[model samples]
Target: MRTIEVFADVLCPFTHVGLRTLVDRRGRYGLTEPRLRIRAWPLELINDGPLDPHHIAAEIAALRGSVRPDLFAGFSVDAFPGTSMAAFALTAAADRTGDPALVEDVGMALRNAVFEEGLDIGRPEIVEPIAVRFGLEPLDVEATSAAVRADWEEGRTRGVIGSPHFFAEDGSGWFCPSLAISRDDVGNFVVAWKHGTEAFIDRVFG
Candidate 1:
């Protein structure tokens, strides 16, 4: 199987939608050569601080009210993770198993716990069960952290524009392809389908 690497933050609302779209539409296109390799793009490391829950809550509100009413229905600001590094490391550990399905499944499960189940994935209590269910071994913390940092560095070299940046092994790339983000006149964020997005999705799964 070909690999399509996606560098994304686990807690990003946008990444949640982008990954969900990929999983939801993959079968529709009747193609599956490119298995998604979910990589880490921890915004906290890039920004040098934990993301503000209030800011994320605002984005979730806009996303839910605009184009994704069916998603994030259980989001809770209080349950938001304080840091995504550990979660990223968890996904990185999954990637190390050399199973694309496990990597993708673990990444999506982490996001689902956060966005739909109102779980604090930063906590072991929340993330551990998901790892165990996927048959993941105990994570090698040092190795996983290094893997995540390597992905961040690679994303920088590849010029990842933001979370959910997809890079095909063939060298084609797209950033946040699932939705178009814009601001309303009053400065509230609005989202819509990007023009020509379906063609790209076809290319991805086809």
Candidate 2:
């Protein structure tokens, strides 16, 4: 199997949409060889502060109104995780376990916990069960944090500009291919499809 690495943050609504699209459409492409290897790109760490729920809420609203009304139906900004470091660590640890399915399941569940189920994933009680269900062994905190930071460093070297950056086996990459975001004159977000985005996905996975 070929691994297509994605650098993303769990709390990011945009990453949620991008990964969900890949998962939902992967089968339709009739290709299973390219498995997603989600990597840590913790936005809080990159931004030097915790993500603001209010800001995320506004982005979600724009996304719902413009692009993905079917998704994020249960999203509540109030339930957003205060920090994604631990969740990123969990995902990095999952990747370390060497099970592609476990990696995908844990990553998606973490994002769903925030965007769909409105759960505060910062709490161990909320995150631990997800790991347990997948039969994941508890990982040491320092080890997992180190793993996440390693991914961040690698992403920086590889030119990951933001969450949901995808890189194919040949090292070609795209930033947030699911949609293109821009700000309007009034400073509101405008979400639209990037031209040839579907072609790009097919090229990577087909």
Best by lDDT: 1
TM-score of each: 0.93, 0.94
lDDT of each: 0.84, 0.83
True-structure RMSD for candidate 2: 1.4
TM-score of candidate 2 against the unseen true structure:
0.94
Residue 84's C-alpha lDDT in candidate 1? 83
Off by over 4 Å in 2: none
Q: List the residue pairs that clash in candidate 1.
A: none
Q: Candidate 2 on 1-206: residue-level lDDT in tens?
A: 67888998888899888888887788776766677889899788789899999989888888888878888877887788898866766787789888777788899988888888888988777888887887775466888778878889999999999998999988889999879898899988888778878898787776
In candidate 1, stretches whose alpha carbon ends up further than 4 angstroms from where it belongs are: 30-33, 138-141
List model 1 lDDT by residue over 1-206, tens digit each. Answer: 67789999998899998888877787666766567899888798889999889889888888888777899978989989998866776787788889887788888888899999999988776788887898875466787678878898999899998998998778889999878988889888888878888888877866
- Estimate the lDDT of model 2: 0.83
Model 1 TM: 0.93
